[model samples]
Target chain A: MANIHDVSKAAGVSVSTVSRVLNNHPYVKKEKVEAVKKAIIETGYIPNINAVNLKKGKTHLIGIVLPFLDVPYFSQLVQGISQAASVHQYKLVLYQTGYDEHQEKEALEMLKLKQIDSLIICSRKISLETVEHYQQYGSIVLFENGEDTPLSYTFIDHYACFMRALEYLYEHGHRKIGFSVNRLEGANSSQRERAYRDFLKLKGLPFHKDYIFKKCLNIEDGERILREIAAFQERPTAILATSDQVAAGIITSSSNYELKVPRDLAVIGFDDQPIARAMQITSVNIPLYSIGQILFEQAIAVEISHKEVSTELMERSTV
Target chain B: MANIHDVSKAAGVSVSTVSRVLNNHPYVKKEKVEAVKKAIIETGYIPNINAVNLKKGKTHLIGIVLPFLDVPYFSQLVQGISQAASVHQYKLVLYQTGYDEHQEKEALEMLKLKQIDSLIICSRKISLETVEHYQQYGSIVLFENGEDTPLSYTFIDHYACFMRALEYLYEHGHRKIGFSVNRLEGANSSQRERAYRDFLKLKGLPFHKDYIFKKCLNIEDGERILREIAAFQERPTAILATSDQVAAGIITSSSNYELKVPRDLAVIGFDDQPIARAMQITSVNIPLYSIGQILFEQAIAVEISHKEVSTELMERSTV
Candidate 1:
């Protein structure tokens, strides 16, 4: 109920001094800061955050648009973002679109409307033009989508990682290989699919259309892929899944059919989630936390310097 | 950058009319709404969200104080919250505490500063007194901690879930059962431990402290519990884990030692996540998404009526 004027009167300081103390500005003298603090405690004054955000012309809020937060991959990325944002004294606003196009549009509209200062898009549902339009308002950072655009990004080279996984499988004497991927709508999934096709062609191996399985994201999708493999007349000896959680599903489902991994079915997955390590599933370990740190740095830079940034990859044990 | 005055002038309407249209007041004419919409589109007018929030005396931003966002349980709950919040046109502010007391305090402070409209305390680290202070500013919703308090909460009956799982194991002729849990500091974990001890006592079976393993909240923790079980001089025939992910870990690790499930070891878990069905790990199914929905309803009711709201449980699968 108490206003800035009341705090200023009580503290025996200028309104600007009270504001500085509230904002934690380093320029304010310790004595003035103490006076304002005392006044605030005594008055039970709660500064209006909306007014503060308006005065600053920016909210220390970052928007994170992800397809599904329940999954391990996005969840881990969110964890990274959370840690990075906390360290930088920024809050994260989550937009869980569930990979819906309309939701993506809505999220972008919020960004353009200045509801959020900047956005870190982890999902691949939005078009490049949509991203560019939103970028005019503030920074738009991409995650796992390696599309070349004006917007900055932090992503793993999915093509390179897929190729590496395939080569490893080939070297390990896996002649017949199959892959399970999510629907090839997002730029990231498309890249992984392209890598799979290219790797098979370059190796002079027959690319069977039946070997490729597409489904929704998650562990259940992986289990469905396993069932499809089991129903195949001629099943592949090795499988490369899109995610570690999916690989876990395959490995667990295969056990039900008396198929032992590495002996009967060698399986590999992407994103070295905690489950991957616990299950000992071979996977491409992307530095999710580092990506979060990089995105946060770029977001801060884009806000402060008004410049675009780029992406980098940190590899781990999956390949 | 255009304010309501600018939009009103461009639309040839009064500022009050524009405000009425913006607030969706029934008194506003359709013709005036159309005119305002056209002006908003043509002039690229975006509402100052901060100013609107200030006028309402509420930010419309709810802060969720979670340990981590990447975990499936929390993420799933967040997904539910996201959908529910979206329906009510509220945005989520994620405050990842990572079990740090300092971060928890900071999040509460932010709430006190009116940065967030409501506080959802999902962390097990902070004490009840600290949470009670934040309740003065806005509604505080507790998740998975059912300590009887004046606060609104959404939590599963952990004691009931644990006992049911144990009863099932006992009925199936499994006498020696080991339990794996996360930190005991968590209210849920403490309840589960108590249930396990009480069940053993009620069954006239000796309870062994060595059979209970406490570790971090992840699949690796599950695997660690299995390793501890493997090293036991007298291994239990059945295991009850705090989560399905942990059960998956135990199953996967047991497979490495050629230990067949059901025949060699019977494992049951809690929170029957998606993987539980795919892997056939019998678990206690908690309505995680419904919990989110309930929390949202409670938050909205508290915001609108300034009254306390409580929680209810919806059962699904595990047992």
Candidate 2:
């Protein structure tokens, strides 16, 4: 309820003095600082942060655009970002796009409106031009999208990880193999699919279109894929899934059919998530947390120097 | 960078007239409105949202206090809240407590500092007194804690759900059952533990503490519990886990030992999450999305009337 003027009057000092105290500006006398503090306490003064942000031309807020907050992958990344942001005394404003182009556009408009100082886009449905249009307003960082223009990002080498898993499976004498992926439109999924195809071609093995299953991201999708696999006359000896949760589904589904893993059907998954470790479903552990750390660092750097950053990968046990 | 003065000058009107037009006041003349709009376009005058918030004495921002964003249960709840907040045109400022007391205190301080208009305590580690202190700034909504306070909330009946699961297992002719819980301190886990004890007492079965495994929230925890069970001289025929993910871990661990579900170890889990349904793990289904919906409704009601709300439960599979 109290404004700067009220604090100034109550402290018996000039408004400029109170302002300096609030901003922690140098050259304020200790006696005047004490007076301002007393006035702030007595008047129950809560500084208007929005006004402060406007005056400073920065909000100390970072916008995080992700597909969905409910997904474990995004949530984990958010956790890492949150930790890094907190360490830097910054706050996060979440924008859930649900992988919609319109929503992504609207979120970018918000960032352009100065509601946030910077943005960390986890994944987007809009074109690069749209993102570039808002680049003038604030720094933009990408996560797992692998865009190489006008922004910094952190991502895993999906192709290498997928190939490693496949190579390991092939070396282990598993000729019949299958894989389940999400939408083929995503950069990561597309890369994984490409690796699957290329590996089979290089190995001189027949690439059966029926062996590749798409549109399987969640548990139900995994179940559907397993059901399809069960109906196949020549079942694959090994299966590769996009996530550990999906792998759990396949393993559980196999149990219902009285098929044992490794003995009947070996399964490997990506994103060595906590659940994966718990289930011990051999998976390619991507450094998701580290990606978050790098993204956060790049965001800070971009905020300070207006430069771009890139991504790296960390290997783990799936293969 | 143009302000209200620029728009006013360009429109040949007083600053108050431009302010009225910007605020959507009903009294502005048609010609004046057109002139103001034209002036706004010509000068690229963007309204200062922070200044407007100051005048209205509200930020239109909500603070969400959560434990961890990486977990599926909490993340799904966040998704629901995010969608609801977006629809209502409110922004969320997230605070991750990681169940730490110091972090919770800092979050409370942020609430008092007016960073957010209202506070949503999703899963808190702070004491009741600390929560009561921050309630003075804005309405506080509890999610899943079920604390009997004046705070508005939406939570599931963990006791009833656990009882139902146990009762179903009893009717299925299972006497020897093992129970697994995440943590004994969490409010939800404590409620489930109490229900399990009561069920055993009602059935006149000796309550063996050894049969009750604590600290099993994730799959690894579930696997550890299974290993412990396997080492037991006399093992139970059935297992009741706090979550389906943990149940999956147990199943996976059991498979390694050549044990079967329903045949060697009948397994039941709480929170009929998607993975549970996909894996066909018998679980007491709690309508989490509905809970999220109800919580959002309560939050909106509290924001409007400055009053408190309560919780309700919805049933699904498992039990």
Candidate 3:
């Protein structure tokens, strides 16, 4: 088999020049690059990374399972993860499962098959048992609560966060409160729902099924929420938006629907993103970037651990 | 070496059952899953996907190199590409290079090493000449104009698009136009600058060096632009925002500076994203999603090709 030295000799270049060309390092002379390519073809030399990774039993690649990138929440998470991954000289393989069970399984399979060194599931649709079964293969970390499952996790207390926001709205004398959610079946959403029911039960407030708005993920969904509110004879005075984008949407389009923020309707948004700060919408500060860093560390850690991240209510206008 | 059949025989199960266990398919009986694991360990069975892929000379993984995933433009592009990639059963390995030349070279090296089947450069800081040399290793596609390069590209005409937008502002009886850009020395920015100079020369308008704003990408940059414009004793009557996020920021914060849109200053945005539609910003519609689909197709195509994607001017209340 032809080696790097053989290619270098054939190309009439130094071994370092051939190495630089093979690595695609910048500032290599065009003529030398061409010569290296010609020599490589002539010698039929192949550079196989898979073979190297197989021998070491480490690919230096982490698999990230996310649902969608267009959402600011997910994008922000990815941003944090990418920043952390780059700092450690690791690359990420994105499995955009779109909340599909089979797609999520493929990510787990990659871990079992040793295609990736570790798996970080930002969100998932697969059962806990199935995910736990693959723990013997490689390190796996979760972004949500992994209670009693023996898996490492970094989580925010969604129920506590929702309860605090709801209580704040109630203290202000706004009994009719509504909230928006994406994926009513999601683990986080289910926690928020449990908090909503418990809050209503404790406060002696009416349980209106109409108060919970589903499929509210982006800014455009705010307009839909307001339109629904406008048509209702009795509307909620305050609402919890799924994201800052949705909160900004409701406030920006408030006048079009003949409503005033905090007067006609108050809004509390999640993920105190830039838009929330720019628009002065009160939001819950979920440090997704810091969380992403913690998740990455957990994915590489030898011991199984769970980290509970805290949240803060960023009070601004609109509430 | 023990294979799937050998493990199945040891586990007292069918080969398909062992296969299902190896793939981590959901809904498998927990007892069978445990039995399969024990059998595999006892038999020293190894399921090497890399070895299988090495023989086929295909990894079924596409690499996407970009500067940032948090940006809406890149995320939306990734969204489209991911949808297309899923249809083709290809996973994506993301290289968040942050426009570092060395990091960009790493992606190219992965192609030469056959770690990724093809690469899609959504945005880059590396020279086109350096990138073109990697075509022999694998299919390389770009999201920018690859003029005179023997590479596949899907691009928007930034010069023509800028000129048309400048003309629209001129027809509206506004001169002394300004524009914002993410990177002043970027290829697209240079084209837009050339168009700006030509537009001003055609109309016999004077150019103000202070009129151009650099490092403007997100919504927060809008406030910075407005503050700078407000500080100017004599400001341009119109401006071209780099993105809808920047434009939304400008318009949303204009009232704080006591400046009204179109009355005090006319504004135009790029990429008619959802925020543009919600905020009614007149923007040049760059169909990034459709362009993403084309870029993915080019990445897998056998032949080299170049595609110039058309842009549309979406008129709204801003102009």
Sorted by TM-score, highest first, which candidate order results?
Answer: 3, 2, 1
**Please, what are the lDDT tens digits per residue for candidate 1 over residues A102-144?**
8888778878767788888887676778778777777878765
Please state the error at residue A152 of candidate 1 in Å. Answer: 1.9
User: Of models 1 and 2, which has the larger TM-score?
Assistant: 2
Question: Could you report the DockQ of all the candidates, in the order they appear?
Answer: 0.62, 0.58, 0.61
Q: What is candidate 2's lDDT per residue for B1-319, written digit by digit as tens?
A: 7878999999999999998998889989999999999999999887765666666867767778887887677888788888888788777888887788888777777677666777788887678777887777777778764455667777667787778777877887888888888668787788888998999999999888898888777777778888898888888888888777788788767877788877888888766677777666787766566566666667656443222222222232332
List, residue by residue over A61-85, the lDDT tens digit for candidate 3.
Answer: 8999999999888988988888899
Q: What TM-score, over all chains together, does every model reach?
A: 0.82, 0.83, 0.89
Each model's lDDT comes to 0.78, 0.77, 0.90
> Which model, 1 or 3, shows the larger TM-score?
3
Backbone clashes in model 2, listed as residue pairs = A278-B220, A283-A318, A284-A318, B283-B318
Judging by DockQ against the true structure, name the best candidate: 1
Residue A184 of model 1 has an lDDT of 74
Error of 1 at A197 (Å): 2.9
lDDT string, candidate 3, B150-212, tens digits = 888988899999999999999999888899999988889989999999998999999999999
True contacts kept of each: 0.91, 0.73, 0.77
Write the number of the candidate with greater DockQ, choosing between 1 and 2: 1
Write down the DockQ of candidate 2. 0.58
Which 10 successive residues of model 2 chain B have the least lDDT summed? B305-314
CAPRI grade of model 1: medium
